[model samples]
Target: MKITLPGSKETLPVGKILCIGRNYAKHAAEMQSDVPGEPMVFLKPSTAIVRSGGVVVLPKQSKDVHHEVELVAVIGKGGRNIPEDEALHHVSAYAAGLDMTARDIQSKAKANRHPWSVAKGFDTFAPLGPLTPADQVGDPQQMEVSVTVNEETRQNGRTADMIFSVAYLVHYTSTIFTLEPGDLIYTGTPDGVGPVEDGDVAEARVSGCAPLRVRMSRELD
Candidate 1:
């Protein structure tokens, strides 16, 4: 899939979307999950992306779908075994994103020791905003990230709360899979994730970046 960025006539082709899980201690506690000694990783396909102002079609298979607002790092360069100090050099931009989840499906999958891809990989599960060039984003870890549903605040936190920093996540993920241009890393969410009903408009934001707004809808029969 291709994504259009602001101020740039060129569109970037999306590659594998790597995500970090339980990177926020409060979020982990809310989910009843223990804080990991290392970054917990996951994957979501490119098809999951819904650009800002898009609609998130809730799957019929899930009874409870939750919203997770996150800070997204967009890779501009490719490398493997990168050092933490230099990892930020590989990022091209930053965006506010939502990692929508089928909580019911995810709970069952966890109970059965199954992968979370099925619960997290549905089309429209990932909603992203326009990119703010990396140079334009100041001190990513100091940014405030938040989410609102129907104009009511649902999540409000800071990137500083992350158990794993963006740079460290890049360095660690690259060791396992070769990082490539257009690849995205979802840096995980904070506490206060909850269910969104049909027609609910969810907006996610990160300081110094455009806000990502999306409406939730039920799958049509």
Candidate 2:
């Protein structure tokens, strides 16, 4: 099974995963949901990832597929109930990532009050960076995160829009899940979420961080 890639040599640091939902007010409302009073958390099995410059295999179950641009943080150490100022200390690295979603399936599951695992967690659903060490990413709070599909900017946002600061989520999440050295957390996405068709190019960038360019294609029949 030979695969083609631009940055195949890049090795990503692994860790327990945390996903923040409804962190961005515009995104929350676009999905017809309210801004969470607190952080909305979710997870993507690490197995779902396809590193940067890799292909995003569009699933056949796709009624509608969409891309969510997010800021991903890698944890260096495990800590519980950490202080906001202290949150920076736990970060090992950062990367710009895409939380690709099967929107129609997700909506159906939500309507039935079912779990999002099947809808959100699938092979090759999470496409990530070209990692940048924490030292390389300064002021994680003020970076620009943007996503474009087929050369058009679909979603553009800033980390400043996050309802729960990184420190808050790090502290808030540790209390629930025992974070490990290899765990990663996807901070959350902003407004302008939409569909990704096969042959689409999904390019993402984090200001002052590296750029990620991925060309998406449908999975083999």
Candidate 3:
């Protein structure tokens, strides 16, 4: 799907949605997981994207669905093995995104040591907002990320608490795979993540960027 860039008429052709797991110490502990010594990389296909103001259907495959608010870095330049200092140069914009997951499915996968793709990569699972240009969002590492469900705060965090900074994530990820424009990096979510039922309105926001609002509805057979 195409993404709308703030203040630009052009649309971005989304490639891949790269995600990081357990990137916050407090969040890691809350999830009963350990903080990784390095970046934990994962992939979500572009098909999972639900653009800003879209609805997130509670997939029928799982009983419990959870919301994970995150800060998304939109890559504008492509490169491999990017330098640490030059990593930000590859990012053109930032946005608020949700890494929605099926908690029940994920837990089962973890117990079986199976890949989490089925648990996390469902259609409409990734909700993203309009991209704010990089220059307008200074020092993304200090930005605040938050989420409110049904007008109640569920998650609030500052990028300062991130175990791996945005620049480092970009650089490190580039070493493993080529970073391309429109490839999104979901930095990670904060400590507060919980289940959401149908009809819940979840609003995700990143400091200085547009808010991404989504409503949950069950996928009826």
Candidate 4:
């Protein structure tokens, strides 16, 4: 799928979306999990993306769907085994995004020791905003990221609280998979995650980037 780069006529094709989990200590604690020594990574397919102002069709199989607002790094340059110091140079843009989750399903999967792919890979599971050029987003770690549902704030935290920095995540992930242009890195969420229902409007924001707004609806029979 393709996403339009704001203020420009060009559209960037989306590749794999790599996501970090438990990157925030409080978030990890709130979920009753331990902080990992390293980043816990996962992948979400491109089909899961819903752009700003789009509708998120909550999956019928899930009773508890939660929102996780995140700072997304859009890769501009491709590389393999990139060094941490040079990682930021490969980023083309940044955006505010939501890593929507089927929490009930995820919990079950975790209990069964199964992969979370099905719980996190449904359509409309990922909502993203227009890309803001990296240069315009000054220190990624300093940005404040938040999420609100139906006008009430659900998540509020700063990227500085991340256990794994963006540069480190990039360098580490590249060591496992070849980083390609259009690939996205969803630097995990913070505390205060909760559920959303039909007709709920959720907004995600990252400092210096366009806010991503989306409405939720249950799948029609």
Candidate 5:
């Protein structure tokens, strides 16, 4: 294999992937989900991660799939019970990401009252990339996040619609679990989510942040 670009010695982050769900009421209703009272947090194993411009393999167990474009907050420091006013102090940077879901499995699990791991934690389910240093994101609250599958826009959400703000997310999540260096917080997705087929090229972006894109493939039998 030939390397085209110089690879930096910078080591990739290894930390918790905390994802919030249904923060936008319109998004929840699109799937007929209820508007939750608080942040619906879930974990994506570090192994599920793929960098920007990487391929996202559709899990074998799923049928219907969906993409949830969101704002990603990368933590620079560790702390618990951090106040909302000071939460930004812990942030390292921001980026765009996707909470790719196995919709069929997720719906089934919901009916069975089961945990969301199987539906949300499969390999390549959390696609993120193009790291932007924290100092660069000027206004995290006003960014635009969008997703497109096969050149068709599926989701377009602005951070302003969030019922619970980013500051509150950090303030709340840290109080429960100590957020350490490299911990990533996926704020949540907006409305308008649907499926992608094999060979579909999906592209997502958080305006003024990072770009999130993936090539879809299925494991051959």
Candidate 6:
């Protein structure tokens, strides 16, 4: 999938979606999960991206689906083993993002110790807003990130609650996978993650970035 940045129509080819799990203590507690000593990483292919204001067509295979609001960092430069101090230099832009999941499927996968590809990597599962240039967004750690379902606030928290900072995530992820332009890092979600049903409107907002709005639809059997 190709995504366009703010003030520029030129599309950037999406390479991959790197997601961090349980990065917030409250969220971890809500999920009954332990906070990891280091970042818990997962990958979602480009096909999972749903453009801003698009529809999130729910997969028929699962009954419980969830929305995770996050701050997304878009990579501008590629590098490996990057220093934390230099990590932000690799960022081109930031955006509000939603990490959608088939909760039932994810739970089953966890029980079997299987990969999360089937549960978290479905089409229309990753929704993102317009990208705001890095220079425009200062101190990402202080930004407010939130999600609303049907106009009722659900997830609300500041980036300050992140267990692992954005720069650290970039540096850590680059060490395992070669960071590349257009690669997106979802910096994890806060507490209050819950189910989304058909016709529900999910909106995600990151301070200083365009709000990402999506309508949920169930695939007709």
Against the true structure, what is each candidate's TM-score? 0.97, 0.91, 0.97, 0.97, 0.93, 0.97
TM-score, structure 3 vs. true? 0.97
Q: What overall lDDT goes with each candidate model?
A: 0.94, 0.81, 0.93, 0.93, 0.83, 0.93
**Number of clashes recorded per candidate:** 0, 5, 0, 0, 0, 0
Q: CA lDDT of 48 in candidate 4?
A: 93
For candidate 4, write residues 145-214 as lDDT tens digits: 9999999999999999999999999999999999988899999999999999999999999999999999
| Candidate 3: Cα lDDT at 145 | 96
- Candidate 1, RMSD to the unseen true structure: 1.2
- 27-68, model 2: which lDDT tens digit per residue? 989999999998888888877788778888888887588899
* TM-score, cand. 5: 0.93
Please write out the lDDT profile of model 5 over residues 81-156, one tens digit for every residue: 9999999888877878888899999989999999999899888888886667666777788888899898889889
lDDT of 6 at 211: 93
In angstroms, how far off is 155's CA in candidate 4? 0.6
**Position 120, candidate 6: lDDT:** 94
Candidate 1 residue-wise lDDT, 27-47, digit = tens: 999999999999999999999
Clashing residue pairs found in predicted model 3: none
lDDT of 4 at 31: 94
**Model 4 lDDT vs. the true structure?**
0.93
* Angstrom error at residue 115, model 1: 0.8
Q: Enumerate residue pairs that collide in model 6.
A: none
CA RMSD, predictions in order = 1.2, 3.8, 1.2, 1.3, 3.5, 1.1
